[model samples]
Target: MFRSFPAMAFRTRCPVLDPAAFCFRPSTDLRNPETVISEPQAKVTLFEAAELLRNDEVVAIPTETVYGLAANAFSPAAITKIYATKNRPQDNPLIVHVSSLAMLEEILPDHRIPPIYLPVINRFWPGPLTIILPKSDRIPAIACNQPTVAVRFPSHPIARALITQCGFPLAAPSANSSGKPSPTIASHVISDLDTKIPLVLDGGQCYFGIESTVLDALRSPPAILRPGGVTFEALKEVLGMEELQVYKKHFVDVQLEMTPTTPGMKYRHYSPEAQVVLFEKPIPLGNGLVPTIDNTNCKGFELSTMVAMTILETDIESLRSSIAHEVEQLLSAGNRKFGILRTSSSSLQDITKNRGSTFKSSTEFTVVEKFLGSALHPEQVAHELFKCLREMDAQGMDVILVEGISEDREGLAVMNRLRKAASRIVTM
Candidate 1:
């Protein structure tokens, strides 16, 4: 069952009195990896979460997109624990979550927002959009490795209540081990962070199963450094942003090494434990998955495909054939099990049918398949993408194959993440 902050608090902001006035609840101590906080779970009330933050202890809080490991952005000691707990690099900055514009104003250098972002903020604030702004001195250097910082105002009631109650900005990143899929539920947090943090306020599953869009309006003709819940089409609708550029395949900033303004920039993130292969084109709708065994027309591949094919056999007939051949090779090499993340347009059952009688007779074939909702409904696919990836990982599959979707609407963000997670990408 899903849960959130109180109805009264959800409707209106309520100022929480000083946490020092309340008796601090004892937090479960976890000294070993084997230690688990079961039953009543490790969920805490808004008041308790506020006290934990006041004590400079890290707690996992749910957001509209994913759970965040939150700490007082003003405290250097508290921020350091977040890095250590997630094994996150010190140089990769964290996003600051604010409850209201007033909280956002308190942290800005001039207590003013840039004029360019006013329209976007007006349209997308308190949602899944994060904006990059100049860092104020009040923000510790440890929280931002660069001169700028990323800020987000989450819409989740539990998240807003906890931040409002704490009366300070929280420096938070996805509450999972660095380089893994971000957590979308309390249990996902516990599975990865387990007693690493003091508490997890279990609001429920996230609305968008991906992270917030990291937009840098500070740049002329703003560019999307990282794609997330906010779509490119949505941002383009805002005035003065029609020429907006995406940092995905369309363009790459050579300056990223010297200036990474957002979290996903300059990092390999959202990867599962298994070796991942992504088929960039949708599996042809009507034909079976495998290509003709007759190897032909293998030249003139796309850049990613060309690079990937250098590793694959020269005789493969088509993209689908390459998939079957790769699976066979892995099976031949004694990797007996695999996993597949299918979109509505593609299916593992198709592959089984393609293999014909050989598929039934093959003793080495084992695959776990999961569907990520309809391709026509990218929103549903976006809402389930990360959680489904984590689910496949838990199944102990040796390798995971993902089907790609068109970069339209939310599919743009989906493809961006898929590119980052894939060890091999074939865009035939």
Candidate 2:
């Protein structure tokens, strides 16, 4: 018979089966050609999850940004299962999730929070922000893979409650197959990790469609290794981070490729099934193909030039034409259906209007458009980005064309994710 561990006693007592390690396994090894499923694992509850964590098993839990494959940070065997289950790179590392400052302190070497991160924690903690700090011996080496461990206090009630009940931190990474889009809903987690893990706590769709921003405060001047729900502007606005630097934007650090300080720094992440092509923000041109026309100038322009200028002055129109050209080329090459992740400034109507009459007549070409929020509200754009990409892939789009936004505020994270998702880029 497969027996479930009791939540009350499980928390206080180490696994009875293993003397060297604390972990739980059924008496019968089903996958060993020995035992069959006496009982199926049910949708996990907080109590069940706490018991499971006590027994050193991995579970799927929800954070505000995405679902996570969580395991007891102290258990090497449990952490190994997470890596094997996700097929995550061994060196990629994981973020340690804490429920409170006390739990966070329990895992730190000196039990002292880094002074540089205090202000950031005051503002962004219990939200979507991850900070890097020195790794402690309490954390298994596999969890960090480097000298420092990434930590965050998740805002999700279930996530925090689970950690608090387990009486320890959880080392969690996005709950999905490696290189796949992070799971925003429990079904996404089940789809990817079914039959591998014992339980998945069904949390609804994540508030932010992307992961948390990974910031390294251990370094001088500080740096953002990955952009997600938290914006770089928010970090900069923090008292101690007024002069903070973001990797790649402020300066390129080549060493990161060889030895990544954070999880996202050395991986190809959040890619969809179809190829993505990103178009940079369109440059506004004035009449006659000159810069925006001012009342002061037009003496050198000709009537025909002005007429041409009138046809394509708007940035949205220019972007539409550029994508339409690409669509035409793809149609000639035999791609049938295409997808557009539209920005507030551009839409399907704009692209259709720009498609040449000849290209519009082609029956083979079909275009699907999804408005991914707006450039003006990058926060909403960030929220919809991954979902849009996954949905487009499901729609069988031969290729996805995305409109780029400025790298400011949440746009910084939006563009970072876009660049990674896109296989090719066409700057407008």
Candidate 3:
């Protein structure tokens, strides 16, 4: 059984208050970076939402990234509700959200921000970047028992306003059921968490449409635990961060996976009900021969490697052919619906438009296609990836074929999600 809740619009009027009285110390810093329009109905809704949060209840709030399931960072009970509501594992830690540097200082040991993070905070704070720092005693074990806690200062006006209104930092993770694609819009939150959570502040679609980059500057090389809205290239350009490293697919840390210090590290996340088949960029061999993958003996959920010392005239065309083969095989086994997530302008659309006519005439067949922007602009792809996945799932696709993009800028984060969501990776 599913439950429902009121998804409130986040257009509340900013009440005039004294600088000292406001939780955010600097009164001048409280204004939204974007335009601020006030509405009376939204004011009442914001107050109600804050009241619920003050009482240790979970509230879904929008951020520049994805919507977050927020609860009082200091309350273990409230934090537990977030875990129960999302069915998130206790081992997976949460990120603490703050409205101001003052609020952040309150949770830090000795009320001091680490020197190493000063440059990063200046460059990326109040945006989609999470930094892992030493946890203070005020932080509850459930939030993150580890010595370090992940914290972010969100630029979203509603999220900042809500935290300031409540007078405490919030421990929040992506506002969706665990292992599912993170919600980019309020409707996505209501669809997944609904009755599980009380209120969702609908601030419209998320600007980043992905989670914040989780950076552990405490590490020797200062590794990025998760690639997100913040790109490695951008981070590398930051002063004193030239040596930063990102944990890629090939680098496996078994201990870290089992006991993740933060979210997105230990779980199989961003997945949908339908099987996701990721088609990676083809690796060309100098020898001129077509490589063939034998799928006759492959069974359920088994990933087989296709390798050959063969050169392909057009790797992209071969990749499209390989995906078509997968679709045909599935259709022959009674799978009637398919979805294609395209990353560039290509002839892949021809498969969806023309192939159905050539399939068995008596069998019902359908194909849905969505463009995840273009590879040249990966941020656009990141923005549309999860939404398209959910839309395809809602339309009841049997399998989703996603064209993989290069690991550049936001493309790293885009491919990271697709790799986790994918059940099979077909490398040409």
Candidate 4:
């Protein structure tokens, strides 16, 4: 029988205020890898940290997806706390983050990892790719509200450390409230989730701000499960495999109204308390999330170009020219409080000028490329978009429109962000 998630805090079994649950320590070096606490004496030694997690206690573990409120995958009760704290939908699955291929065997039932996927995993694991395979009888169906579970081996050191110390695989999801921006820093987890969860291990910010790229390799056709750190193009580029696009149903579960599958699918996930809309065609409107109704009652919303576009791929110079043109349209529409931020590609160039390097190491170029660039693959671009948006949002901007990326490979995942991040959509 599936267990009911606790509605209240797990204070009795696990006290949040207990001194034994937390320890403080001082480290002047801000970049130290093992540093978990900010204040002196707040750092618990590894022994204490292991005991804290082993006791079915909640600990905020950092991952590339966001900080996950980790619980032993084998402990249903402990896992329940994660659901309770996040207020996540029970039907949505929880991803299992393992430390290594060896740890994966503990959860998997000797099923051979797929041959095609082997190279994909080799190229992507310890990073952001989540693969869904046949579930063992051992898997709890509640993980993603699906029979097949999502699993990944995170590349984050602190995330792996907590799991190794506890000696159990962890079922984790993005630590913020479900459908919110994933927590990239320990402070982010603390800000959004600290009160509800137990201890948060303060590692530095995540290199990649979005969730992992998820693919369902168990199926014959092989579905791109969910787009994140992994891009579909990267997968194809690395493996030289052919990808068949799967058209996802817009509304599978009515409880979500019209949200798609996956955790954030049921609701408007990743919105920063601001409304986002997507437009099939460009519209010069700045209103957040209100349904756009044409005279004939055709409904639509403006999306950040970042999410809704499958713009022609070009070089950095052409890309910049195109964006400057778009930005002019947005500015002409009376949308002010303006700023443009780029985490990855900033060009408007045609796709012909693709040079597979990460920011070719010049400050002036990184700045220029951030605003105007050429062809950008999803994996290359998805790395920094969210964090850039959040920072831009903080600068007191009202409406921000971003361009979308190609929908091949990890592009599927990039398109996911483009769809979700905008308060509206305008496909140009």
Candidate 5:
């Protein structure tokens, strides 16, 4: 019943889907399902995008979290194009996107949603939460051969409309090159995947600006494989998720990484071309009363007084000194340009003023600073993290210094991505 669209023919026949022609109201709420498209041209564009998917062509569609490179989940041929286009690792599995619970039922092995996920589904469906379930015969093994497949019900109207129009579950991953930062806006997808895929349904900027919170409810205690838009606190509030565990740096699983059941597990993900250096929050001493600097690689700089101050007090100055020290070291290695992703509300003027007082005039390196929202509001940080990384990378920075945030709520997911992206971690 399903026909495969030849990659060459699909590319030649279908012109790039223009974002100007296709626009939708930006909303993440699942209950309110009114009109999504603003212009009539968007309807025609949506149909053309759906047609490409029906014919097994990979189409870039926007999700509430990020844009996804989608293809028919049932067709191995279609899924193959997704892998080739993105150069994604074969071992890393793709998450299937569904429009409704009925579509989700069609992909399960027994045509029944897993009992463990019923409560979670009720609360977080049509959101940024992804659940892994047993795969049916219809879903190709290339999608996920490990007996289970990761699936999501995206709240983005264009993504939902496209999936519903195609009349099938779509296996879609973040519409960017493998291991690179995920695309939050349609332009990010077009920039990374230009000429690689046929159509990218431009649904404007994604609300979450990250990936979905992937949960494997099949496991005991139900661990979150990858944290994203959904916070652990939110999921823990769910009826059966009181004991939800997150697979993070402290909780390392070798077997899971070797054969990841979900995406963002086994690979070096959320990275930019420039080297990322993450400055983590200081950890408390063994007594949990006093804070201690775990590591600060600033040689020849005095940090005794800075270390004595409480964790909260050691904010901007400490970070500036550490970054200046790092830049000085890199300067010896002949590196010129540097970028800093600030977590605080500090402005570029503040950084510039401090640079004059901090670094020697003789040090001839350029430092560009961009704020990633305040630490008080972690949601703003999450939304701006990847975009800042890409922007800094585009500016030809040799190194990027990211000031880490407290691991609470959305900060947990933010730190998770930073940990994976960072080549070096500094505790301050």
Candidate 6:
């Protein structure tokens, strides 16, 4: 049946799976008629997966956040390989992905489960949400550049199988090459880091092509460290919806540089090569009314190479049409060139199936459809922001304006990222 990648041999005595044994190129096959891998054989091999992981080597594993190149959290050599392969800054520590509550207890300081977090963990575990807690003495300082380390229980079976097999938390970063795009398929993994890493258990595609939501349990009422699958609204509902108190409750120290005890806390993260400019959704005053341009600072769009991003399926065209129609009416208005990265639900589904991998645990999401709807969800968008930005950026646009998503379910995840990607934030 589905066994933790059964090893052909033992770890200590087992010879490395001849790195050549793997195809440098991944199989082009996508869409497993059956969305879920109910068949035992359809799952990933775990023992071999562990052997590779233990050796301080990289293993491309799937997570709700994105496809990640993971390593033994405790091993310094393994951590270094992740940096070298992804070209990620060493100062930016990595998140530790675990399979169960037992594993978390084994690794994290066995602190009292604050009553406040109980409901949250019960609701969102084995998914994309991450809990940052006090570091266990046994943990490697490298896991968290700060005093607290970020940990998660991935819902993907293959991912859980691999992590449980490894017997240690795996420190994983998005598998794609550094600063490029986060990989969602076997090909994306291969394109970015095939030879550099050992084995990648092709587990179809990822549902949430983003990072996990990182919440700080260290705070009273709880605060979000990094946004991901779980939304702030979700957090508020579970934890007594009170206005997040600043100054006092939100006492988190932002991690930067390889500071002894935190990870993934530092760095201008989730950015694509293209410079993202945030714009106001509705026309603002002064530069207010028509023109569809925010006059407060038209300087960001002064250059003609800027592209205002919006979903092709969205009614955004009404405003766009209005802007083009009124451009002549508005004096001193500038020539704003647009490069659109529009994709319809069906077309996006096709592209996700053809290009990105499907999530093994769920079928509700696809690669392209993730950007649909409104409301900003930073975590989900963060997962694919780099990829989307990279695509538009490649076209040679000067400034990239990402259309805002409704801050609903996946939309919540999109907004956080849009806020960061857009130079200026706007609402439609």
Off by over 4 Å in 3: 1-37, 249-251, 282-312, 353-364
* Per-candidate local distance difference test: 0.74, 0.73, 0.77, 0.56, 0.77, 0.54
Ranking by TM-score: 5, 3, 2, 1, 4, 6
- Ordered list by lDDT, greatest first: 3, 5, 1, 2, 4, 6
**Pairs of colliding residues, candidate 3:** none
What's the lDDT for residue 372 in model 4? 20
lDDT of 5: 0.77
lDDT of 1: 0.74
Expressed as tens digits, the lDDT of each residue in 61-121 for candidate 1 is 8888888999999988788778878888777888999877778888899999889988998
> Per-residue lDDT of 310-371 in model 2, one digit per residue for the tens?
65455456666677777667677677878888865654455555555535645556678888
Candidate 5 stretches with Cα past 4 Å from truth are 1-38, 283-321, 345-351
> Can you give the lDDT of residue 339 in candidate 5?
88
Q: Which model scores highest in TM-score?
A: 5
**Per-prediction TM-score to the true structure, in the order listed:** 0.80, 0.80, 0.84, 0.66, 0.85, 0.64
Question: What lDDT is reached at residue 323 by model 2?
Answer: 72
lDDT of 2: 0.73
lDDT of 4 at 412: 63
For model 5, residues 128-235, the per-residue Cα lDDT tens digits are 999988877888775456888899998776788778778888999999998888898777887788877888777777888878999988988889999988899999
Show where candidate 6 strays beyond 4 Å: 1-44, 240-265, 274-278, 282-338, 342-387, 390-400, 406-409, 422-428
How far is 411's C-alpha from truth in model 5 (Å)? 0.8
- Write the residue-wise lDDT of candidate 3 on 1-428 in tens digits: 11233343333222322112213334346332222326556556668878988898888888889989999999887887887788887788999998888888888898888888888988887899999988989998754458889999987777877787788889999999999999998888878876576678788788889899999888877889999999999999897788999876435678877777888987799999999988886433333333233334111012222332122325555766787777778778788888889855544566666665544445667788998886667799999988999999999999888878767789899988999899898876
Q: What are the per-model C-alpha RMSD values against the true structure? A: 11.8, 11.4, 8.3, 12.9, 5.9, 13.6
Q: What lDDT score is found at residue 112 in candidate 6?
A: 48
Q: In each prediction, how many residue pairs overlap at the backbone (N, C-alpha, C within less than 3 A)?
A: 0, 0, 0, 73, 0, 43
**Superposition error at 27 for model 3 (Å):** 8.9
